[model samples]
Target: MLQIQELVFDAWGRRFFDGASVSIPKDAKVGLVGRNGVGKSTLFKLILGQLTIGGGEIRLPKQARIGSVDQEHPATPVTLLDTVLEADVERARLLSDLETAPPERMGEIYDRLIEIDADRAPSRAAEILSGLGFSNADLARPMAEFSGGWRMRVALAAALFAEPDLLLLDEPTNYLDLEGALWLEARLRKYPHSAVIISHDREILNNSCDHILHLHDGKLDLYVGGYDSFETQRAEKLRLQEATRAKIEAQRAHMQAFVDRFRYKESKARQAQSRLKMIAKLPVISAVLREHTAPFLLPSPERPLAPPLLRLEGVSVGYGGPPILKNLNLRLDLDDRIGLLGVNGAGKSTFAKLVAGALEAESGEMVRSARLRAGWFHQHQIEALDPTDTPLDIIRRIMPEASEAQRRSRLAQFGLGVAKAETTVADLSGGERARLLLNLVAMEAPHLLILDEPTNHLDIDSRRALLDALNDYEGAVILITHDRSLMELVADRLWLAADGTIKPFEGDMEDYARYVVDRARAAARAPSQVAREEPPPPPRAEPPRKAKTPTGPARRRAEAAEAALARATEALAAIDQALLDPDVFAKDPAKAADLGRRREAAQARLAAAEAEWLEAAEAYEAVKEA
Candidate 1:
């Protein structure tokens, strides 16, 4: 368990979190919810001891273990199993040493070895990897071979394999597909350790977290239950706050009127002074709540789309090989909210590009309706932006017809202040760049919007804003995203791209997920039937066993290695504990430096033990199999 007391974080003379205090209960699953730029990730980093707090304290219990997914993992040519097992390398070394220990000292080390092995179980690592959608065969695959999404999975597996008492996850599900996201949700819901997750996926937060911490306007507001419940309660609380403010204003006005009338009277002078003091003591109500300023503006269509916005006839799209989308025929009508779903490396993006006219199909004809003007928003389209142009300049260029006031107003709607808008496009964050692209596209007022992974870099608020805009738009939308909740909210029909075909399903995203899960199950079961029909491999000849026992000096050397490995394992555990100590890293930078040095020392020891263990194991195996 951990508690943050009067925490304040400031940067460049601006306060991000001001006097925020909250407690994380033991084994509790908590969600950090807020708009973009409200410091959700900042708060997570503060708790993880990755950021220094400007004021107050973060109190964590002693000897607690913590694990987190690094936002960026180095592209190393290590195997997936090697990366995950790296979480507790010293423990693995210790286990190998125990396995090769002499029988005489086994009695002395047995109890300690049992305790260490229980804390570092390889089966737990395997289970976490499998649950996160990795196959047994994938364990030996190099990490460098995986894409960004799969690499994120590897990072998550490493965190989970550490088996920390508290896990701090920042946007953990950003790269996860629906299947992997669901698996993670299930795991977190029943997880024994506590977790504080900062995620934009509403479904994940709702399904996995029991409590919600809403950080808004430099304050932390705690709520019981998940996202949906939090929404309901927050709305009620805001309503009451508004009502109280109104009553206070009325009373203040009445009292002011009384004072104005009686100030001239000598007999009522003392009473008037008392009323003035009482009125001054009254709390000042905020003129506008943060939620009131939210952008509810929807995208307005400049012209009505024709009956059929887009039509594909006998479309065959592919690369150098055979067609991935073969003979696809479909018509997209105006006001259609179509959700495109498929597995990784499928033709979803290809189909989207073909529809957007960004790519030419291998064969067949495509048609766009006469009145259908299209605006395309791709995940990588930010590269098209001029790095020299500021966000404000880009907006002005894109919407040249708009006045200066209108450009600034629109930019502010997407969470960019006047100062931030003046910053160069090259200096903007990934999320900021995405929002700018969206703003540009929205200003075009096209009759059809083609978005491929538009939610990639957006936080929860920006996503909701985009979703709301898409939902209210009078134009047709063809969206390709892995976010199921966004699909459910904004999509009316499902278009599944798989097996070199684009199949249409008439249902919501929930139904689509269910259909996919059922199909995956059926597909998984088919391999067993084929295996049963095939003949098994022939048995190999047995190897001869070893006859002699170990010598005295060899036994002593093994015992010494085992003792060193045990010490290394303990040091690794200490490093894990140090990583979670916010007081050390946030309050005392020197202590953090010392902890880092010790961690490096422990890692060196672990590597040495691993080398010794491998050499000893090789020798033992050669003798036993001789």
Candidate 2:
């Protein structure tokens, strides 16, 4: 369905695709795998015509439709169900044409609509939305009422509903919870059209994809079967390559030695010359370079904590209003590895906070050993990092009594080398920032570790490294993540947060996945029963959003803030691109240092611009509300 021949693309002072070529079979689900800095996303853009190729060609059928979710769906007045149903352009057009068409044309339109199963579009769209964590009530809600993240889900739902010939998804599971991720995995496996997904989630790649497309060192290698099979195939191919190169090198060396030994002899002169020529014609094989994954440092506690380190009896907790988690009775031992499962907004973070001592229980009894120490690491910690702050700066603050050398050494142990130690957080990749925070949180060797969505930013290899570190660390763990593979491998038991309470899950990860899929399917079927009881309202009859715009000072401030944010964002991207150069630090340390300083300044500007934008936007919304 999709083909690329010697495709070449270069931008931002580097080559992303250097004669990279691959073919995707029709209706094949392929996973694009690569390191963080690799050009997987760029490949998607090139295929989408958002980026021009420097050479060669990318080909698809003449009328092939391509679909991708570039950003969140726009906030509008359309009902969620109608928004997705409208994604079927052909169906929408035919239905619209039926309003004013002649009798002959009306028959054609109706026939086409029937062919496309237009009547079932609503049910299908609702199923997609339900699998993505939207409730049945959300179907009738205006798009303007949802948050940005929810809108992104709606965009994904639209793409899936349309079922274009070729679908491109970049980290589709990033915005989804574990339940949603599970549903998506099963959905992708049965997708009728071809799909190319860029995802670091192992379970998705293994379960959803039929093939793996690996991007490495400016080349693409297509492997048959899932991620595990791809790994095995790649390893064997490298081994064969190395063996061939060694044999060729030995032949060349022997020929050269023969030429050197017999060049002066009269009888052997012709033979020597012939050997030299033969040696010159020998093929040159480059050595394969294996990529390295930096190790994560998670130290174990100096002394083991007492068993039952934490116990809760009828514990209830909440911010101020009703309790998000009520009457929770649980116990944590020194050696337990507990996997916490829940959907978004399901009190998982609240439970983590309560255990981390960031929150106090509102009622009931909660007990903890006096010397118990807990290390909490969540995705929010990475978001809350100061853009201008460097690993060096952060380490210095934490180790005030230590010397500069000690601080640098500590940062190094956390996988931040000398070059990255002084670089600002804004210049670091998501994986780097995640690694720094993960190690920092576990630096003191707490008896218990509470990790939430820890693998969201990490690549497959980095995630494996983290899994290894977690396994080696001799401490109790409470792991909350959407990554099924990691959770299954790390956790010895399972706990689920649902229905405003926490309880022990009866079965394993596989059972949980089945349950989630079944639940979503049941929810999707529920809306139809309700429709039978009461007449369904037309989506178009729903109220539209109020058409109000900010005026005078509010409008002016918002426009200025938006402009400033654009400038700041562009400046930061340029600096980030420069810093991403592989030889930036090696070839010109001085230039790298200058870029680092500029990036720090740019980050500060970006932060200020974002804050101003948020304030202005809120004020403008307030005016509209008034």
Best by TM-score: 2
lDDT of 1 by residue, 1-626 (tens): 87988888998668998898888888889998887678888877887788999899998889888888876455688887778888775566666768888988667566765776755355566566655656566667788888777888888878876768889898777676655666677678877898889887888779889999899888888788999899989977876677668668767887898899998899999989989998998888776466532453446676675456777778898776888788777777765677777665567878877887777788888887766667888877887777888978877777789899998888888678888889988888888888777767766677777887787777776777777666557777788776768877666567766667676755555655555444334324442222211111222222121332323223324445666787788778768766775756775699799888988988998989977766665565554454
Which regions of candidate 1 deviate over 4 angstroms?
Answer: 88-94, 99-137, 248-288, 292-308, 311-314, 327-329, 364-372, 399-421, 442-444, 505-508, 512-626
Per-residue CA lDDT of candidate 2, range 1-626, in tens?
99999998889999998888998999999999999989999999999999999999999999999999999999999999999999999998888898989997888888888999998888888889888888778899999999999999999999999999999999998888888899999999999999999999989999999999999889998888899999889988987788679678878888888888999999999999999889889889989888888889889899987666898989999999999999888888776788998778889999999999999999999999999989999988898999999999999999999999999988888878999999999999999999999999998999999999999899999999998788778788999998999998788778888778777787788988887777666666776543211211111221121342313346446766987999999899878977886566985799999999999999999999999999999997797577
> How far off is residue 519 in model 2, in Å?
1.5
Query: Can you list the residue pairs that collide in candidate 2?
Result: none
Sliding window of 10 residues with minimal summed lDDT for model 1:
530-539
Task: Please name the candidate that would achieve the greatest lDDT relative to the true structure.
Answer: 2
Instruction: Name the runs in model 2 displaced over 4 angstroms.
Output: 264-266, 528-626
Error of 2 at 543 (Å): 52
Q: Model 2 compared with the native: what TM-score?
A: 0.84
The global Cα lDDT (0 to 1) of model 2 is 0.88
